[model samples]
Target: MHINPYGEDPVRLALDLINDPPGSASELGRRCAAAGLVIDVPPGAADLAETNRFLAAWLGVVDAPDETARAERLNALLAQAAAYPRLTNHAADGWHLHYRDPDRPLAAALRALISVGTALHLSGRGMHRLGRCAAAGCERPFADLSRTGRQRYCSPACANRDAVRRHRNRTAADHG
Candidate 1:
């Protein structure tokens, strides 16, 4: 089985959606496809609202204080979503397991995919894998798939900015 929904991509998709929300159902479908998720059905008005609510709730899991706390939050979410595992090959590429039924609504599918993907990621990787960017002033959350597991920022640009700021602060302290 291809685990973690292929590493950081699933969480990256979640971050992208959270950072810049889609304005319409079509936009959501487009964004999900762009993020490598195979969307079999397009979303509608209700799907959009449902997706928005789901994402907001999912953010709470990301913002949880600790691993155990995060797991509890995620488990609650999964229980609420209440999907079962099944196999699908929407794109005709190959068979893969889905935690949702084929005919489920778009929002429900997203909830299942995002929640299950998140659980797989955290359990397979590490609890510290998901967190808010450590860069000053950037509150965006990210999933770290780095080999060393020391990533604290969303991107290299943020990391570089934080590093420069730290260096300048240390130099100023020494001079003063």
Candidate 2:
């Protein structure tokens, strides 16, 4: 069965790339493929640099403090990647929805998928679901997919760190 590649996978891939950027186009292609993106192009060095530049811009949207700012930033991305939605079997697993034309290079396809998927994810889930980790000293971006939608940290480690901090404060207050 064809899974929805446009949702969690793309967001996760964006986070992974943002956290640990690829060193080369080949590496970017490899990592993206590992993250469920099907790359058709033999990526060149330029593609890697270009994708990173694009991601930096996208990160601006992720970092936007308000929903209005986020939407404006995302609208710019969507306009840049401009493609009509269509159903296709690009993966050949089965027919599914695509927001891009077929056979585009890895960089272009990523721009479309990541941008649009992020927009959908944020709007469908909640505007507050995407943000930098709330844990002190951790600036990683994350798309919160938690059932309760209250997630603010990038990982369990960060969550635990914040929890410990709060617990320590509470204990100190009690002692005082």
Name the top lDDT candidate: 2
lDDT of 1 by residue, 115-171 (tens): 888888888888778888999899988887887778899889999999999999999
Model 1 misses residue 151 by how many Å?
1.5
What are the runs in model 1 whose C-alpha is more than 4 Å off?
A: 1-3
TM-score of 2: 0.91
* Alpha-carbon lDDT, every model: 0.84, 0.86
Q: Lowest summed-lDDT stretch of 10 residues in model 1?
A: 1-10
Clashing pairs in 2: none
Which pairs of residues clash in candidate 1, taking residues 3 or more apart in a chain or in different chains? none
Task: Provide the clash count, candidate 1.
Answer: 0
- State model 1's lDDT: 0.84
lDDT, candidate 2, 1-176, per-residue tens: 33244677788888889899998888998898887777778788878887898899999988998999999999999999999999887788888888887788888989999988888788777788888899999999998988788988999999999999999999999999
